[model samples]
Target: MPGLYLIPTPIAEPFVLPEYLKEIRCFVVENLREARRFLKWNFKDLDIDACLFLEINKNALDINEIHVFMKNAMAQNSDVGLLSDAGVPCVADPGAVVVEKAHELGFTVHPLVGPSSLLLALMASGFNGQCFAFHGYLPIPENEQIKKIKSLEEESSKRDMSQLFIETPYRNTKILQQLLATLNPATRLCVACDLGAATQEIISKKVRDWKPEKYNFHKRPAVFLIYAR
Candidate 1:
C-alpha cells in the first residue's frame, strides 16, 4: 500500500537516517536545497537525482497542489515522504497541510522517531511537563512582546503550567533580554540553545539570576521555557 511518511530531519549536527527511508523515492520538502543536502549527507549510497523532490512553499500553501501531489502518488502506488527544514514535520512546520491532505485521501501516515528541539528542551527544563503550552513565537515589538511575556508568566503562575516559545536565531538575545526584564524575579526560565549539537547549552535560572552579559544566544537556534507558581 502507498504511504505518507512523516520524516524528522536533524536540527543540528549529527544526522541519522532510518533504514526504511531508503525505499522512498517521492519526497515533499520545505526547502529543496536543504532537503537534498540532508539526503546526501545521511544517505550516502542513495542516488538523489533518481528520487523525486517536491518543494512546498512555506509562505503560501496551496491545497489544490497538495491534493494533486498526494492523489497522484497514491494512484501510482508510490510512497511519499514529507520532510521539514528541520525537526519533525507538521509540528511548528507547514507540513501539516500535506499530512491533513494525506489523511483525507486515505493514505497511511507513518511518523518516524527523531530529534525534536521542543521536546528536548521541555525534558531538560525541569518544569511542569504534565501541563505545558508551546507558543511558537512571541510578539516582535518590544512593548507587545513584554506584554505577552507578562501575560504568559501570569498564566503560568495561575495554572502552574509551563510556557514554551522560540525566537529567530539573530533575535535570540533581544528576546532573552525582554524576557528577563519583563518576567517576575521569582519566575523560572530555561534557555536551551543549539540542542542536539556539540555546542548545546541548557541554562535554567530565575529571572533575578539571569545575567544577560554572561550569555550570548545570538545567531543560535534556541528554545525558551518559563514557569511561575
Candidate 2:
C-alpha cells in the first residue's frame, strides 16, 4: 500500500469494538498516554510493538505544526493509519489533512467500514436512503448556518443531497436548536449520540419534537441528519 488508512475509533468507549483495534495502525491519536492505558486494559495480551503511532495534542501543537507532521508522515509511509478525537475519521473530524495529502501524493488509501455516526444516523432516520449526501459540517456565523441548512434541505429534496453533518460537542445542542427554529418543522431529523456505546441513543424525530426538551451533548459525540423538507 502506497497511501493512507483512515481508521475509525470508538466515539465514546474504547472497547466498543475490540476487533478494529487489532486490524490497523493508529496515527494522529489525540492522547498518546491515554491510548496506551486503553489498549493495556483491553488488548494487553496482543503484541502491539510495531504499530505506527503519532500524536496531535491541542495543548502542544498549532495547526501548521500538525500539518507539517502529517506531511512528513505521509511522504515516508504508505500504510500508516489516521484517526480522530472521536467518531469516524474525516467526517466533521480530523484526518482530512493527511488523507488529502495522501491523495495528492498518489497514495492508495483505504477507508475501513467502521463506526460512522453519519451512516448510523442516516440508517436510523427512516429517511429515503436511496440517494443521500454527507456535506460534512457547516461554518460558523448564524447566516452561514441558515444558508447551509437551507441549501442542504433544498438539495436533499430537489437535488437529492440528504443532509448529514455534525458540530463540536459543545455546540451540538445549539446547532440542533437552530435547525429546529430555522428549518421546516416537518423536516426529518436523525440524531445519533454517543454512538456504539452503552448510552448510545439514535433518535429519529422531527425538528419540532427536538425543541421542546433541552439536550445535553457536552460529553457526547453527535451525528445529525435531515432528509429535506
Candidate 3:
C-alpha cells in the first residue's frame, strides 16, 4: 500500500524542504499557487511540470474526490504528499478530514519533521511545557473573548499548565490588546510573532509590563501563551 506523506512546509523563511520531497509526485495543498511556488523555491533541480497538485482547503474539500485520488495513487504504489501553507499539516490547519479519510481507507500516514509555531513558542516560553493546552483561536465577541482569556488564566494558575492560542494576522494587534486588557496584570504572557521567519520575535512578560506604545502586531503572524503569576 502506498503511504500518505505529511510534508511540513516552511512558515516564513526560505524553503528548507527535506531531500525526500524530491521523490513526491503527488501533493494535497491548501493553496495551489503557494504550493507551486514552494516547490520551485525548495526543489530547484526538480521538474515542476511533472507533479500533481490537489486542493483540499476549507472552501473546496470533496471527500469522495480525495478518496478516489488516494485509492488510484495507492494502486500505482505512488505516495501522495499532504502540504500545509505554514507549519505542520492538520495542526490547527486544513487537512484533518483528508487524513481521517486516508486512515479510514487504510493508507499509511507518515509525518516528517518541520517547524511548528506552537511548539517553538512553547519552547521559548518559560511556562510549564509538560502540561499545556492549545486553544486554537479565541472568541470573536468582545465580552466573550475577555471571558475566555480570564478563564484560561484561572485554569493556568490552578493546574500550573500553560494556555496557548492564535489570532489572524490582521487582528493581531486587537488580540494583543485584548490579552493585555483581559488577563491578570500579574499573569505572564508570551507573544511569539513571525515565528520561524527572519523578523521572528518572542517575548515573555507580565500583562502589566506589555506597554502598548511600543507594540504593534498589525499584520504579523503570532502565537500567544498565558501562565500564572
Candidate 4:
C-alpha cells in the first residue's frame, strides 16, 4: 500500500483526523509549519522530527520538485500524503500538479473523503447542482471582475447551470459588492461564508433582494454562487 494519499485537513475548528493519517510518515504539503502543526495537533504521540515533509509552492508548483518527491517516495516504496492548507487537496489548490505527477509516475493515488468548501457551498446554494462550474477565483481588477461576473451570469443563464467562485478572505466584501452591482436583478446569488465553522452562514436570494449593509464577510472565507436561469 505504498502510494500517494490525498488527505484532507479541517477547514475550520473541530478537526477530524482519519485513521489512515496515523500511518503516513511522508507528506507533500503547501506549508510545512501548518502541516506539522496539523499532524501534531491531531496525534499527540506523533514524532514530528521522524516524518518527511516536502513543501509545494502554492502560487507556482514546480514540476521538478514534484517529480523528485514522487520518485523518491516510489523508490523507497513509502506512502506519501498530500495535504492542502485546508479542506481537500487538489481542488482549487496547486496540489493538483502533485497528483498529476504521481499519476505520470504510475503510482497509486488514494483520495480520502473530507469537507470541500466548493461542494458544500453548491449543495447549500439551491442552484442547479447537476449543471454547474467552479471558476476558482475571478479576476481581481474591478473592471475585469465586473466583466467576468457578467459573462458567468450569461453562461449560467444559457445552460441553466450554476457558477461558483471564491475570493481572497480580505476581498470578500469587495467581490460581493461587484457581484451585486453587475448581475441582473433577477439573477440568484448565494453566499456561503465561514463554512464548517460555528459562524457558518448561507444566504441565497435574487440580486435585488441582497442587503449589502446587513452582511459583512470581510476577511472571512466564503464561496459565491450564481444562477440566472
Lowest lDDT sum, 10 consecutive residues, model 2, at 15-24
In model 4, how large is the Cα lDDT of residue 60? 68
lDDT of 2 at 201: 78
Per-structure clash totals for the candidates? 0, 1, 0, 0
**TM-score preference between candidates 1 and 2, better one:** 1
Question: Candidate 1 regions off by >4 Å?
Answer: none
User: Each model's TM-score?
Assistant: 0.95, 0.71, 0.93, 0.95
RMSD values, in order shown: 1.3, 4.3, 1.7, 1.4
lDDT (C-alpha) at residue 226 in model 3: 96
**Candidate lDDT values, in order:** 0.90, 0.69, 0.86, 0.89
lDDT of 3 by residue, 1-229 (tens): 7788888888876658778768889888898888888888888887878988888865757888888888778778888889889988998788887788778877899988887899999999888999999999999999999999989999999999999999988998888888887878899999898898778888898888888668777798889999994
Quote model 4's TM-score: 0.95
> Which 10-residue window of candidate 4 scores lowest in summed lDDT?
13-22
Off by over 4 Å in 3: 58-60
- Candidate achieving higher TM-score, 2 or 4: 4
Q: What is the C-alpha lDDT profile of model 1 across 1-229, one tens digit per residue?
A: 7899998888886668888888888999999998888888888888999998778955777778888878889999999999998899987776988888888888899998888899999999999999999999998988889889999999999999999999988999888888887889999999999998999999998989988899999999999999999
Question: For residues 1-229, could you state the per-residue lDDT of candidate 4 as single tens digits?
Answer: 4788888889986576876678778899988998999889888899889998889855666788789978888888888999989898999875888888888888899998888999999999999989999998998877888889999999999999999999999998888888998999999999999998999999999999999889999999999999998
TM-score, predicted candidate 1 vs. hidden true structure? 0.95
Instruction: Please say which candidate is ahead in lDDT: 2 or 4.
Output: 4
Clashing residue pairs, candidate 4?
A: none
